[model samples]
Target: MADFTSRRTLVLRRFARNRFAVASLILLVLLFVGCYTLPAVLPYSYEDLDFTALLQPPSARHWLGTNALGQDLLAQILRGMQKSMLIGVCVAVISTGIAATVGSVSGYFGGWRDRVLMWLVDLLLVVPSFILIAIVTPRTKDSANIVMLVLLLAGFGWMVSSRMVRGMTMSLREREFIRAARYMGVSSRRIIVGHVVPNVASILIIDAALNVASAILAETGLSFLGFGIQPPDVSLGTLIANGTQSATTFPWVFLFPAGCWC
Candidate 1:
């Protein structure tokens, strides 16, 4: 416990020492708060139609203006952000967890187990994930599709990371403690969980952070391509998609979401 605390403190100190990382962390926190909370506080709804205000420029009355459907641009963008965040965070966690588990097992227990897992990883590497997602997502309904989107991304995202984990675990598994645990009749699962997992956790944590950004961008791209969140289900991607044709004439529609995407 003391060792874990010291490691955590060290990580915190390391993170704090990096000015850009600190600033980015603060900015992300603020952005998340604004995206998730401001919508409930505001009077506007993403789906609410204001027939009189179609494509109006930004004003105090409509902060980011209105879309062609007269939906509040600010509200739509916020809603999009909320969905995107959900997909990003969930996919990152799920992907990282799967990666850690798969990698640990494959590495620790070599032979057919390793062969099968590596084979699957290699197969996934060659697969066209986004196109498959595009082909399948539209068939699912909106709310369910969002969950499915997270699952699909996480499912596809873990392969490379898992292969990395397996390599790390291969080294860790041959350590004295691991061998000792095996000789002492400690369960393979327990040793992997208590020893192997923690040792590789730092890598997984970093990968998860990176995965969130990747997942968010993936969601944005898929949604923009009309395979993700879909219409009436506004996410930043959908908002950008809606604005594409009139991006020149009504730049606010496209630009607001694009800025948020950045």
Candidate 2:
């Protein structure tokens, strides 16, 4: 209990000292809240467009002004944030989970399993991730299809996490506590879940946050290129792409979405 309390206190103190992490956390929370509330409360749907109001400047009625299609820019931006964040989170979770699990098991077990998994990881690392995503996306156009694409992105992206976790597991598996647990007949699953996972969770969390940012950027790139989230679904990338032609004349078109991304 004392040890647990000490660790908890340490975490709190570390978080307190880490201003960037705290700020990022706050931003993350605000983004999530915006994603949930903005779409529901918005004056118009993302697809609702009025050509008559095209390219209007920001005003009380149209908060961020109207796009070429005269859709409410603020509403589209809010909805786009939702979609971008959703994709980012999904990719991060799926990728990290797969990587962590495979890495932990391989590192703990060793032998042929480790060799084979590491080989696969190396193979994935050698290939171009964006190319793979482009190739896989057109196979379907449903939400499930987009989700599958995200998963595929995650799967290919896990090599870094796998290597990191494997190294940590190598050191951890040799520790006195691990040996003691083993001698006490703790099952492998218990040792991994109750001990290893908890110990490595902090690193995993940091990596996951970084990975989320990367995934969002990746999705944005794909969408900008006309391959990511489809129409009726306005991602930041798609919004930027839509506004690219008139960037000089209507800078708000790209500026608004890009601001949200930053």
State the lDDT at 164 in candidate 2. Answer: 92
Model 2, 1-262: lDDT tens per residue?
7856765665556555657766766777788787778778777777888777889888887888889889999888887788778888888888888878988988888999899989999998899989878877864347887778788778777898988998899889999999999999999998887677766766676777778888989888888888887676778888888888888899888788888777
lDDT of each: 0.85, 0.82
Q: Give the TM-score of candidate 1.
A: 0.87
Whole-structure CA lDDT of model 2: 0.82
TM per candidate comes to 0.87, 0.89
Clash pairs, model 1 backbone: 80-235
Q: What is the C-alpha RMSD of each candidate to the true structure, in Å?
A: 2.8, 2.8
Per residue, candidate 1 scores C-alpha lDDT tens digits across 64-121 of 8998988899999889898888788899999999999889999999999999999999
What residue pairs are clashing in model 2? Answer: none
Clashes of each: 1, 0
